[model samples]
Every structure is written in C-alpha cells, then in structure tokens.
Target: MSTIYKSEAGGREIQRLYREALDTWPVPAEHLRLPTREGETFVVASGPRNAPPVLLLHGSGANTTMWRDDIPSWSRKFRTYAVDLIGEPGLSAPSRPPLNSDALALWLDDVLDGLGITSAAIVATSLGGWVAVDYAVRRPERVTRLAVLCPGGLGRQTTGWIVKALLLRPFGRWGLRHSARAATGLESPESGPVLDSVVATFMHFNPRTERLPVFPDEALRGLTMPVLVIVGGRDAMFDSHETARRVRQCVPHATVNLLPEVGHAILGQTEPVAEFLRG
Candidate 1:
C-alpha cells in the first residue's frame, strides 16, 4: 500500500502515461449531459458503450482526473464512467447543489437514467463514498457491488482535528486546491500536469463542507451491496480502524482491508488498490 514512485522523472512517467491513456480513452457513442433537479449538468465520460459498467466517483473537491491514476487499470476490467458530481464542481452547471443525501441520491439516479446504465459496480473515495452508501441504502438494486476508499461521513463528531481542519474548514479546501497535491506525492507538477488538473478539481468539484449530510452512520448501516471496505492504517482524516469496525458491524457481510503505512491519500496506494479493484 506504500509503494513509492521515487524521483521526479518517475512520477512524471506515470503522468505521461496517464495523459496518453486519456487522450485515447474512447468516449462512448453519445455521452449524456444529464440535468439534475438542482439545475446542473452532470458530465458522464466513459469507455466502450456496451461493456458492463463501473462508476468511479472521485473524492470531494477533486475532479475525475484524480482517477487518472487508477483508470488504466480499472477501465481494463470494467467499462468505466467517471462523473462530475452535480453542484460540487467540475463542468457540472448549477452553482448550488443539494446538501442533503436524499437529493444527492436523486441526482445520481438521474445520471444513470440519462446514461442508460442500469447497474454497475461503484468505486468511490471519501465524499464519493458517502454518496455511494446513500445510494446503496436507497436503491440497492441499481448497484451490484461497492468499493469505498477511506470513506467519510462515519461520524463527524469522532473525526480527528486534522481532517476537521482540512475538510471541514474552508482553508482546508484551499490548501488542496493550492497545496496538498505534493503531500499526496503528485510532486511532478510539470510532468503530471498537476497544476491545471488539480486546480480544476478544486474549482469544479470541491464541496462546501457545510452543505453535505452530517454523521451518516444510519444510511451506511442499511447498505446491501457486496461491499469492499478499505482504509489506510495511517489515515488521520477519519479513524481508519473505527471505520473498518463500524462498517463491518453495520453491514455484517462487508469485506474490510486495513492497509499498512498509507493514509488518506489514495493515489499513492496504487498497487494494493489495483488488487482491490481486481478483487
């Protein structure tokens, strides 16, 4: 889980590969720009039109480019579609998105209806994970499997000061849009084209921390997918161990993996995540 891509050149290589892969990502015949009740355009970008789909939801304040790290590996197994959550950021239109979980779920449903995706395996990170649980709790039939990475919305009350400071505070959002990229080992700014992509993620996807649902434990407890729960042993944003414990207790059937060394940064946890995707 803690493999290092040492040297600026090494990191740049990954970025180079990513840019090339995206250039030829093969957009579907007719991509849809679904209109959510909130009046936003949820952009859906995907692979081959007919393959069984996998939905990739990026973390809060980040765009689909964050998936630039995992897409090559993922798009191989499942026809993947990375969506820009309505109202949160990216190319999605409406400035104000729904802060409530129920409305968020409706937005997702609209996205699926517009895309013609009846069912899929969802892979979500942090805030994205929160929405996935909300959807599983509401419309389990639409999702066949779920994989969440160090998800959020467990209990904001139990959250550590670091995460609360970064995600909960406005400054935290700015730091990532301006800072945290390097802390996540995306140091090759010129190589990976980090500045532009990361800034776009911040501008378009960053959520207003005050807007999303709070303390989402009840909805998670009601989820019914073949859930694969993952957490970094060193995660400081949310309690990784507590998250694993509570999720196991809530779902009973969920598979949990407590990875060593890695923290809230999922981009660097590529190998283990690659295997997790395969699993």
Candidate 2:
C-alpha cells in the first residue's frame, strides 16, 4: 500500500469502497489502465467509441467518482473518459509529481497519447482544473474546449478553512463532517451520505499541502481555445471573485459563471457544463 493513506488497513478500505462505487456506475463503461511515465493511469470510458472525446478530471483528494452524477448526461452526447488523477485516493498509481515542474503536463500528454487522442475537450474541477489550465497553456492546440469549476491557480488560495478544519479535527467524526460542510457547503440533511463519504475518506487520505502555483496573466491569456470558468462566490478555498475577474480580463472570450450562494464545491452543473462542452 502507498503511504498516501495513514495505514495499510485504511488504504485497503478506501480501495474497497472505490471498487464498490465502480460496480454501481450507472452506465455501461470500460475500465482501462494506461501506462504512463507518471505511473499506471486509471480511466473509466463510456459512451459511443466514435463520439467526440471529452476528458473528465476530478479535484484533489477525489477520483473519477466525482463525475458519477454528471457522466450519464455527458456520455449521452460525447465519449467521456473519467481519469483517476495520480496520487489521489484512487486506483491510479501514487506518483505525485511536483506541481511546479512540467511533470504533470507531460503525464497528461502521455495520457492523451495512450487514449489515441490528438485533441479532446476537457472538463475539470479544482486541482484537475489546474491540470487542465496548465496543459492548455503549455499545449494549447491539444485542447479543443476547456471548462473548469472552482479551479486553483487563478486567484489566491485561502487558508482560513484549513485553520478551521485543523481546530475541529480532534472532535472526531462530527468535526470531520463539519469541516467537510465548511469547505463544500453541503449542509442539508440530503447531503449526509455525501458528507459521510468525505469524512470516511479523510479518515485515511492525506491530501497535498503544497500551495498551487498561481498562473500569471500572460499564461491565462494564452488560452485561445473556447473556455468556460464556473466558480462559487462563497468558495472557502480560492478567491472566486478574483478568479472571475482575471478570466474576464485575460480570456475575454471565455464564459464565466459566478454563483454567489455556492461554495468550493459547485454541484448541479451537469446540464450547464454539458451545454458548454457540446458547443
């Protein structure tokens, strides 16, 4: 077991649960493992093989399961590949290449090549959004369309939630649930199962602590592809207003959505994002 988890038992549990989630995937899918320099990459492929390709990247500490709610809708129109980011709590290898280096971009290049793709649309969230933006900036021609949600690297990241989460850590499961709620804004009774899964994961998972390198205005301006950025105004993580302003000013042609009531986790964007990807 990789040291990304607190212990071997915890690692086993996380994998078991992930497998269970995979078993319950709502659509017909093919699980594939692609060899890359970063390590073995895991992808769940769905939709018609001949349809246009759409790459799905999940946020930090998450796996392809993050797209489960949206895949059914997205796969209907396009071939969707939900990639389990390396180093996250997923089936992928635990190879965490430095974010400041070009390693991740190269890893993604290997991923695209392995998928037999020359160009594809990308839908990513949070850390995955950072990955997509980095790749677009480095290899703009390979990305057909770009859509991101609450991604890092545009606005300054906040540590207030980190302090809050740390202070509440010793209180056990209740504390963890509150911490999850504080970060994600999923507080209703209906969000219990979601919160429970988050708590369960954090019980073992060790999330990356490095501050994501912020992209310069020059880098943001290099995104000439069709772009869409969706962020939460009340996000406890990144400064969404700054993110929105920068995207508007830099990528003037980009579509930006700022949801005032939402937080770091932006939910129910399946149809909106689908429309953007369709275009």
Candidate 3:
C-alpha cells in the first residue's frame, strides 16, 4: 500500500517527535509489537500484569501518546494497553484500510487475539470512539465496557467546521493554532504545545481526509455492554447535543455526559473515565 506521509524525511521527523512525546509518559511503559493481519501493531503496555485490562484507542492523527496524561491514573488500578491505530502517525503500519467496512473490527480482533486479551474495557476518543463502537457491535462479548470522549459516528459532522478548517490551511501557523484551539475549546498554556504538535503533524503528514461514518440507531442499540458517552457541548466536529440525545435514546443502558463548557478535547475527563472503568 502507498504511504500516508508526504516524504521519508517528514515521516522520520514525525516519528522522532512521537518518540519524544512517548518519553514524557508519566509512568513506566513497555513498548510491544504485535503481528496482525493488517500489519504489525504497536502497543504501549503499563500497570500490573494481573489487573483487568483496559484498551486505549486514540483519535485520528494521534497515537498511544494521546493517553500520556491519563495513563498514570489508569495504570494504578487497571492494566492499560495504549494502541497506535494502524495508518496513523506512529510506529504502526501504514496500511490504510477502508473506514466504512468491518476492516477496523477485524484489525482490532487481530490485535486483541495477538495480545491474548479475551475481553477488555475500551476507552477511546473521536475516531477511536468509532472503532470502539464498531467493535462492540461486531463482537459484543469481547468488550467489557465502552467509554468514549467526543466520539464521532453518532451524529452528522458539521459542514461549516470542515469549511473553516479548509480555509485555515492557507493562513499558516497562527491560523492553524486558532482553529485547533477553537475546535478543542482549549486556551493558551494548556493548548500551546498540543496545538504545535497537531499543526506540525498536519503539515508533515497526509492525514485521512474522509469524515467518520455515522452508525445507524439499530446498530447502536445492539450494544449490550455498559456504555459511557461523553460529548462536549461546544464540539465543532459534530452536534454533540444531538449525539448525546441519540445515544441515550437508542442505547437504553448508556450513561451520557454533555459538558457545556468543553469542546472536543478529553484532557480533563480522564478521572471520570477511570472511575467508570473501575466499576
């Protein structure tokens, strides 16, 4: 398959930055490579060996490092496996599978089977949320519980947001930073470095351009596992209010939280997510 990076040098720089970010992980982590049908998968394992397992799936354009701030707290109770989703900017393979099919479900099955995890609690954000939901619906018995932050595939994406993002591309760093902050609802200090990495990745890598597909209500209703749906009231990607409402209405056992002041970022909700996972 073709590479998603613009060039080899660009890919190396992104990888270097990724390694640098991984170094900042708050707790000790063990890096592992698991062979899968899609390709070789990269996972960062932490916490006790005997504890219950929790799988961490990051948003689009992000990798295992997305959980840097959350891993320390989660590792204290549960064994956490932070995966670098294949096709993203990480150590994982660059094979781009079809997003609208069961490819992701199959890929995840390979990862879990390779790791010998019979079942795990899934904690995901954005695109990763879509993967979690897809896997849960396809293999309900393998997922103990599901906790998603500002996930897609629940409601339609906003066209205005897409247009705004496209428009910002031509204006350079200042514009990119502004757009990133607006989408995340994050301000200076907290958003500075994060936005820098985000902008750098966009400039250097060829991120998937297709929008995440929305799942049908029937498909969502098929999920029998306990579900926690957290959406930001100010999220620019999708209609968070509508997403929460639909999830609550369709998934009878789901617990939905809509943070009015937040956007697409999940930085502050790690504790709540951990508490839910513990139970």
Candidate 4:
C-alpha cells in the first residue's frame, strides 16, 4: 500500500518526532499496537486497569500526542486510550477510507474491540469529533458519553476559511504558521512552538483533502448517550454558534458550551471535559 507521507524520509522524520512527543506524556503510558482490518492501529494507554474506559480521538493531521496536556488529568480518573486514527500522520495504517461511508465507524469498532472495551466515553476534537459522532450514531450502545470540541459535521464548513488556507499554502512555513494561528485562533508568539510542530507535520505529511460530511439531523438525534458539545465562538473552520444551536435543537438534553474567546483549537478544556466525563 502507498504511504500517506510525502516520502519515506519524511515519514521517518514524522515518526521520530512522534516518538519524541510520546516521551513527553505527562504520565507513564503503555504503547500498544493492535491488529485491525485496516492494519495495525497504535494506541497509548494510561490510567488504572479497573477504571471506566475513555477514548481520546484527535483532530486531522494530529496523533495521540495531541492529548499530551490533557491525558494526565484524564488518565487519573479513567483508563484512557489515545488512539492514532488510521491514515493520519501517526503510527497507524495509511489506508485512506471514504469519509462519507461507515469505514471510520468500523475502524473504531475494531480498535475498541482490540482493546477489550465494550463501551467507552469519547472525547474528540475537530475531525476526530466527526468520527466520534459517527460512531455514536452508528453504534450507540458502545458509547457511554460523548464530548466534542469544535467538531465538524454539525454545521457547514466556511468557504472563506478554505480559500484562505489554500492561499497560504504556497507561502511556505511563514504562511502556514499564519494559517495555523488563524485556524486555531491562537496568538502566534504564545502558540509558536505548537504552530511550528503543526507546520512541520504539514510540510512532511499528506493531509486528507476531503471535507467532512455533515451529519444529518436524524443521526444527531439518534445519539442516545449523554452528550457534551463545546465550540469556539470565533472558530474559523465552521459556524460554531450554528453547530451549538444544532446540537441543542437536536439533542435537547445535551450540554453545550460556547466559549466566545476561544477559536478552532480547544486548549485548556481538559478540566471541564474531565468533570463531564466524571459526571
């Protein structure tokens, strides 16, 4: 199968950085490679053996390390599995599946089954949020509770954001950094290191081009688990207010929080998420 990375050398560099990032986990983690229909899936497991399971799915172009700051707190309360979604820039298989189909849901099922988890709470961000919602709608019995941060599929993606992103692509690292800050709503200086990492990945990896498929109202309404939705009022990728409104309209009992000061990148939300999971 063809690799998703730009080249073998670039792939190796990303892998090396990924390993280095893994070492920075706030808590000791067990790295496991589980066989799935897609291929081998990589997982970083932490927390107590007897605790309830919680799955952490990251955004596009990110791996399990996206939760480096959030994992320590989550792992303390529940057995946490930070999964590298297949076909992303992680150690997982590079098989790109159709986003509009049930492929992601099936892949998630394989991962959970391999981990011996029959049911788990899901905390997902951005693109990962779409995957979590998809799985929940398709296999509601397997999802205990769902929490999403600035997730897609709830509202229409902004064309302006796409145009701006495309325009910035040719300007090299500087332009990419600007695009990252704009997309994330993070200040460049304070977000420099992380943005640099993001740029590095973007340069070396082949990102998914397909836009996220919008989840239908019926699917949104089908989620039987307790749901928590958080969005940045200033998010550039999608209409955060609209997304929150849709969730509230579809799932009346769902908890929705709109942080006006925040943007597409949801950092420092681990506390509230942990509380929701514990509840």
Best by lDDT: 2
Mind giving the per-residue lDDT tens digits that candidate 4 earns over 10-41? 88999999999887788988999999888899
- Return the TM-score for each candidate structure: 0.72, 0.98, 0.96, 0.96
TM-score of 2: 0.98
Count of clashes, each model: 5, 0, 0, 0
Show where candidate 2 strays beyond 4 Å. Answer: none
Lowest lDDT sum, 10 consecutive residues, model 4, at: 186-195
Q: Please write out the lDDT profile of model 3 over residues 17-64, one tens digit for every residue.
A: 989988878898889899988899999999998999999999888888
Instruction: State the RMSD for candidate 4.
Output: 1.3
Order of the predicted models by TM-score, top scorer first: 2, 4, 3, 1
Ten-residue region with minimum lDDT total, candidate 1: 1-10
lDDT of each: 0.63, 0.93, 0.87, 0.90
| lDDT (10s digit) by residue, model 2, range 52-96 | 999999998889988999999999989999999999999999999
| Model 1 C-alpha lDDT per residue in residues 145-190, reported as the tens digit of each score | 8888878765332344345336634665466544444333344444
**Stretches of model 3 off by over 4 angstroms after superposition:** none
Query: In lDDT terms, how accurate is model 3?
Result: 0.87
Give the TM-score (vs. native) of candidate 1: 0.72
